[model samples]
Target: MAGNKQIIIAIDKDGYVKAEVSGVPGPDCKKYLSLIEEIVNGKATDETLTAEYYQQSTSSQNDQTSLNQQNG
Candidate 1:
C-alpha cells in the first residue's frame, strides 16, 4: 500500500493497444487491465503475469486474521 500505482498505455500505428502496470503488487494489477480494456473497447487476447503478481499485497500482509472468521 505504500508503493505508487501507475498504468502506462501505448498505442501502435496499427491501433494495437498495450498497457503496463507498475508499483502495484499482487493480483491488484489485474484491475487496471480491466479498466484499460474498457477504455479501449477491446478484449485482451493474451496476458502475462509478472513476478509481482505472485507476491502478496502489502495491506494483506499487515491484516490481522480472525481465528473463527472465514474469508468468504
Candidate 2:
C-alpha cells in the first residue's frame, strides 16, 4: 500500500466527474480510479498522469539494490 492516499472528486453542472489523486506514488493511483468508478457507476473517458505516476514508491525504491550485492 502507498502512503497517505487521497482522492479529490468534483462534479460539474453537466454531471461530468473529474477526480484527482494525491499522496500516492507510481501507478498505484489507478486503484483509486476504479473505486471512484464503482461508486459513481461511470467510467472514466480521460486520464492525465501526474509526476507522481512516474515516481517509484518508497518501498520499491528501498527494495532495489546494486547488482554487485548479488555476487556477495
Candidate 3:
C-alpha cells in the first residue's frame, strides 16, 4: 500500500469542532489543508506538514531503459 493516505474530520467536546488528517506523507501533506476549510463553515485557520509525506511521492520514470527492458 504505497502512495495511499487518509483524511479525518470530527466534532469535539468544546463545540469548536475539529478536523484532523492522518496517514498522509508529511510537508506537502498540508497542500491539502484547504480541503477541510469548508467544514464547520470556516471557523478555524491553521495547518501542519510533516517530512515523511513530502518524501514519499517521488516517481522513478526511466524512458528509454523502460522501453528497452520491455522489449527484452
Clashes of 3: 4
Global local distance difference test of model 3: 0.42
**Candidates' lDDT values, in order?**
0.57, 0.57, 0.42
Clashes of each: 0, 0, 4
lDDT of 1 by residue, 1-72 (tens): 467676666666666666677676666676676677766667676666665566666622111111111122
Q: Once superposed on the true structure, which residue ranges of model 1 sit more than 4 Å away at CA?
A: 59-72
lDDT of 2 by residue, 1-72 (tens): 546666777766566677777776666667676677766567777777655456566521111101111111
If candidate 3 were superposed on the true structure by all CA atoms, what would the RMSD be? 18.0
Clashing residue pairs for model 1: none
* TM-score, model 1 to reference: 0.66
Which 10 consecutive residues of model 3 have the lowest summed lDDT? 61-70
User: Which stretch of 10 consecutive residues in model 1 shows the poorest summed lDDT?
Assistant: 61-70
Cα error of candidate 1 at position 24, Å: 1.4
Q: Which residue segments of model 2 deviate by more than 4 Å? A: 59-72
- The ten-residue window of minimal lDDT in model 2 covers 61-70
Q: For model 3, how does the per-residue alpha-carbon lDDT over 1-72 read when each residue is reduced to its tens digit?
A: 544555556554544444555555444445445555554445344444434434545521111100001111
